[model samples]
Target: MKLFRIVHPLNGVQRLLLTVWVGAMWAIGYVAAPVLFAAIESRMQAGAIAGTLFSIVSWIGLLCGGLILLVQWRARHRGLSRVALSCIIAMLIITGVGQFGLQPMMADIKAQFPAGVEMSGELRSRFGALHGISSTLFLIASMLGALAVWRSAPTDL
Candidate 1:
């Protein structure tokens, strides 16, 4: 009983939660964010500063997720040495960077809604579609990372 007590109750929960979160974020970032951030125009995909704000929020979210990964590591590593600390850390860093620093560099990504910039509904829809594709890829990567950790768990290690 004492030995079991030593184990984290959320032994599997952390990775599961991570998987779910990644999927959810991918959907939000790729689907919801663009829809909400960009404005509809008749011909071009034009958006306001809201898109930029979304990017900033995204960076903050990634940074926060990295921090959560640290907590997950400390909580789950007692008997699971095969799931190395360094690998998890590295994954967190990579994801954090991509989420935080990469999305803001789009060619037409404006800082805010310009007073009179013309945009099209199709463009915003296209942007959302592309964002969805990228986020789906990101979600896949996160799932693979979680699966790697799970598969690496050794009975003795």
Candidate 2:
């Protein structure tokens, strides 16, 4: 009982969650997104599907990251806790901006110029700029997540 008490309930679960977060991110973003675009005849359809996947992945990231932070806190690993918190914040910020800010703006731009119509050059340029920013932020969050997982691992030393 004493030994079990020392072991947090979410000990190994944190590792699993972290694995799922990172794996899904890479698999969906890199592999599935491209495949979706290729398989789908319409760019709009492909974009919608990809965006939904990204949103789901972002939620998963938030859940896993939050739980991992809790686990780190329970372990009293202050440094690890800090790292986890930072990673979670980065993930949340990236996801929020992409979902709420960029996605909406892109949708508005697309709406302004429906299918078969030439999109406004200014709107197109703005959408492209937002896409680039979102992509960079997402990439940074993904890398931070990987780093957080590495730092959370048990160190034999």
Candidate 3:
């Protein structure tokens, strides 16, 4: 007995892209970030590695989110399309704020402090606050991406 239905080729492609994008976000944000800190002896080195990885993830997110939006826009499923659109927009915004706005400020703070100097001052407080906000935004974006993936998955539809 046949147990599965064939979906449009575009649906498969879209789902694959979304899965990879969401998985990468989780891996980079949750896994790699912590690993870098644990493995690297220097805080600056760990931060640099994590920053580079996050920047790459942000760019990949933009491309994948844009592609998902384009495909969903042309799809016949209006409700799904709307949901995907909203989630993608939110993800994009969160990524922009985290990567463009917060990351740079944090980097600037790091630069202000001398090497081997513990960050203990107004700069440290600001950096810590921005880092918290950035982390929260990344988590939110990951959840929103997962939502888009769920809405786009192929099954009965």
Candidate 4:
């Protein structure tokens, strides 16, 4: 089809997008976040910085995922598998839930406390629970992203 023809040449671009997106997920989640916590004296400040990084990565995932999905959908007949498509969709959904759903709830909890102050009691428990869920979701998405990158190899199809 015309769409496939238009998108066919984007195979390399799609792979590049996937690499960047997944690489960022791994770097920020595993590397930078931990460093921020360990190096920064103020837990609140460290958390704020890590949260911002996560938010940026989430946005990147959404954009790259959208574009990759468009390319994959258009070129589906050319060798791109449904599994790859499904992985991207799953990643997008996870990112959306983290960004739109869980992050706001966590933010609201944080907002209840004074600046530079650590949360405690019921608020601390609630925030911790939400953070745990968000972290689990992020980990799942990162794993899926790794799988997707592997599957995108030229010979894998």
Candidate 5:
């Protein structure tokens, strides 16, 4: 009973964190990135801007996800569903793969080319493939975030 009293307030905090994290993911991936690509004249410039935004959002996810996991861990006995926890973990892993893995390879490929010179043939194909994988991973993470938020709700729990 005492623990419930302490953990109860954290429920609101957890919900807020989830909302912020998932909302950022949707806003950045679906809205802002596309707008940058369409509105900006230079593909390289647009990509750079979009990449920075993605990096920022990824860090936001890491922070929010870490805090949410800590809160869930603390309140584990309070009927928190394992599904929600699993979703968060999966989202984190996706974020990691996108950030640390695919992004670096793509960046390296980009670095190989000169400032205005575009990649050709094999390099272009490889970059395109990596970007596609990154985008797919981002989509999966966004969906998982939505699932986590839904499953972690007090009503659902």
Candidate 6:
């Protein structure tokens, strides 16, 4: 919407903030995906994936997040400009779908997990550890974005 550009402002600070937001989303997605995948892996209630879907999907999501940020930077550089940023923003809109879109789909997956299968406490904890590391990476990406913005970019024509 027009309100986002108006409110967020396309200055250095905003650009950095935008990058942080995107990065965090990716990190969290990776972390969460594994947790969900492990849970699904444990249940193995007939229809579960033979390999890891969430794991790959999560990695893809992370990659996409970085790519999208690059797209934003390119847009700022007057390459794609506002149109590029808008398209990237539209892509980010998919990121927001997680709060709603993903959870519902995952609920069905959770239900598919059979009760009797035993998943070790350590495995669950390890997944948590991965989540933590991935989350830290996410934060690091945000910090990098802020640094990139604050350091000054070449705006000369």
How does each model score on TM-score?
0.44, 0.77, 0.84, 0.90, 0.89, 0.35
Ranking the candidates on TM-score from highest down gives 4, 5, 3, 2, 1, 6
Candidate 2, residue 136: how far the Cα is off, in Å = 0.8
Ranking by lDDT: 4, 5, 3, 2, 1, 6
lDDT of each residue in 48-82, candidate 6, tens digit only: 44214433444454455456566556556533335
**Which sections of candidate 4 miss by over 4 Å?**
1-7, 76-79
Q: Clashing residue pairs, candidate 1?
A: 43-120, 44-119, 44-120, 48-112, 48-113, 49-112, 49-113
Which residue ranges in model 1 land beyond 4 Å of their true spot? 1-7, 29-64, 79-91, 107-109, 112-157
* Whole-model lDDT, model 2: 0.76
Candidate 5 residue runs with Cα over 4 Å from true position: 1-7, 77-79
Residue lDDT tens for model 4, 25-134: 99999999999999999989999999999999999999999888887668773544567667888999999999999999999999998897889999999999999999
Highest lDDT, which number? Answer: 4
lDDT for each candidate structure = 0.50, 0.76, 0.81, 0.89, 0.86, 0.45
lDDT score, candidate 2, position 66: 73
The deviation in Å at residue 155 for candidate 4 is 0.7
Worst 10 residues of 3 by lDDT: 76-85
| Candidate 2 segments exceeding 4 Å error | 1-7, 70-81, 115-118
Best model number under TM-score: 4
Candidate 6 lDDT (Cα, 0 to 1): 0.45
State the weakest 10-residue window (summed lDDT) of model 2.
1-10
Error of 3 at 71 (Å): 2.3
Q: How many backbone clashes does candidate 5 have?
A: 0
Clash number for every model? 7, 0, 0, 0, 0, 0
